[model samples]
Target: MRLWAASVAICMAQAAHACETALLLTIDVSNSIDVAEYRLQVDGLADALLDAEITDVIVQGQSALAVVQWSGVDRQELSIPWTQLRSRTDVQTFAAQARAMPRAFVLSDTAPAEALDFALRQFADAPACDRRVIDVSGDGTPNSGSDPRPMVRAAERAGVTVNGIAIESMGLAITNFYRREIITRDGFVITARQHRDYPRAIREKLLRELSRILG
Candidate 1:
């Protein structure tokens, strides 16, 4: 009985280590976002994770995820630590944590460059996985900090894919900027027609990111 238990524990430990992807979700909490908008972003993310298709992919792939709330140069908080989604319970727990998480910043400028830099550093502590991705969602382009192009290049060189979700509340300016300067060569961008459409866009993005067929 003792030998059987030991064997099972070893197999479980090995399975836990076999993650297919490490995904870091970076959300913008700049001053441009009103309180209502912030709530939408937060709730939308939680809802996206709960979507049936998204949850299915997460469980099947054993994807590890983390969330960062980013704004100004000095404002980037790890809202949720890395959590592996290997089962229904794990997905439910992650969604609950995301829904309950508080906003990290309220009155800061948009600084995509600094946010990207901070996100890159996060991968150092990520679990071993087949892919590393940073999914940055923002409603504005960079208004402060260094240029993000170089950092985007650096991320690509480090074998990390940086994708983007552009909230088009202010028009396509942010979306164009993300396409040209933010997303990596192999990464794709999702466009939210407005802040209200964030949940749908996030669901699609998560599905693509977590699915083996699309990934």
Candidate 2:
């Protein structure tokens, strides 16, 4: 009877923790991003995850989150591992860890292709969720490594969505580049006029994505 009771408890726990969405957030740490800009990006993401609405959705939806820092080829690091947000404390703890994460790469080129490829491979280790989304935020087009178009196609083929946040300083050049080559057909892009606008842009992006998960 005890063994049967343990089996039932394990099944109940698994049902309670089923993952709804696996979200992988990628940050650019190439040479273009100055120290201040990097801080703004990381802190902004931390704050966005802590927003009441975003936090509620993440916890309620049983979302699993991870963060990857990427720059030049072979310079992507999973700064935060996949964490299941089962409660407000879980979300808050993850946000705090995000804010405290150190830079993974510096003085490197912008290699979106490598970054996207790296982000895609990470999903293999993430929790099994109904939706797999990669949120990649960058300021410039790829200047090093292979083309990113292939990785975008790969994401689409794998049924994973690759959204982009373009930090544009010169008009819509970066935004247009992302639209043309980065995100998948089911993915979208949000444009931040400059590094200072990162906080607002990331908050809006998170809300949009999490709300869609709720729907």
Candidate 3:
């Protein structure tokens, strides 16, 4: 019985060491996010990915990340492919690559629900990740395309956690709407208190989320 207990302990240790987690990050590039704001948010996200503290928890080849930019309607474009965030160097490389990605398309209206749908499809076939998450950022409520309710429900069903980073320089009322209508359990929302503080808010929020997800 003693030998059996030791064997089980070893197996559990190995299993824990071999665990890998996958996470997806989505940014809004819709019209509401003006040109200057767009650059801030995009580059802020890139910086967050590079932060040492955020990458410290990645277990070698066992952790991965992917990024996508979403615009009006269902236009979700991949910014970076899934990559093993093994070391600080890997984090730097990934952030550099993301920073190189352009705004790609102009914005029209907010369609967060569509972004969720596209993210679901993009990540559905990813290798069996230990913990899967969809980190999304947006400024306004849904104004175009499909409704967000069904897709949000589907994401929850698939064991994917949905976190929101709502830019709220506009007001608290809109942010309140997002908190209620969207965002999932075990998830969080970070706000850009003022339009000028968007970059800082996004970077801080993303780094926090990365830490939580990897932990």
Candidate 4:
């Protein structure tokens, strides 16, 4: 009986290390986003992860999460290293780290394509998962770097899904831009009417995306 109990514990520990999905949350820190707006983005994500529903899914699914801050063509930083959430405590710890994450780039151009490319490359170091997704949130369209369409195609070929959250102020122009150029065929884009709306939108987006993985 003792031997059987020990074997079961080892199996459970190994299973806990297997990630069901890998999620890379990328934030845009371009010149268009002021310091206050940057705070909203990071804080919003930190809060979103702590949501009951989001936390449940993350813990249950053993999801791997990472954060990337992106700006110009050559400016991108992995603000948070990949961390797998095996329990609610793990999720809470990651949320705290996210809230305290320092700004990676500022006064730089918006380069979604380069950002996407950079994000895709990081998966090489992440724990192997059945599904991979990149969640990109930005206030404006790309102004520098190569066209994003090709990069979107590259993501598709690599079996990675690219989703977007458009933080728009006056119109749906950014939303439309994201749909047309950023998200993959199997992915989606959520619109935050304004920077202040990011928390709600990000929560909604995470629920949808993670639920899909769970389903």
Clashing pairs in 3: 31-107
Off by over 4 Å in 3: 1-20, 59-61, 213-215
The lowest-lDDT stretch of 10 consecutive residues in candidate 3 is 206-215
lDDT of 2 by residue, 1-215 (tens): 99999999999998788887899999999999999999999999999999998999898789999999999998999999999899999999999999999999899999999999999999989999879999999999888999999999999999999888999998999999989999899888999989999999999989888777321
Q: What's model 1's overall lDDT? A: 0.90
- Location of the lowest summed lDDT over 10 successive residues in candidate 1: 206-215
What lDDT score goes with residue 161 in model 4?
91
What ranking of all candidate models by lDDT puts the best one first? 2, 4, 1, 3
C-alpha lDDT of all candidate models, in order = 0.90, 0.92, 0.74, 0.92
If both were scored by lDDT, which would come out higher, candidate 3 or candidate 4? 4
Q: What is the lDDT of residue 106 in candidate 3?
A: 88
Position 18, candidate 4: lDDT: 77
Over 1-215, each residue of candidate 4 has an lDDT whose tens digit, in order, gives 99999999999998877788899999999999999998999899999999998999988889999999999999999989999899999999999999999898778999999999999999999999878999999999888998999999999999999888999999899999999999999989899989999999999999988887421
Ranked by TM-score, the better of candidates 3 and 4 is 4
Query: In candidate 1, what are the lDDT values of residues 166-190, reduced to their tens digit?
Result: 9997668888999999999988889
Q: By lDDT, is 1 or 3 better? A: 1
- How far out, in Å, is residue 106 in model 1? 1.2
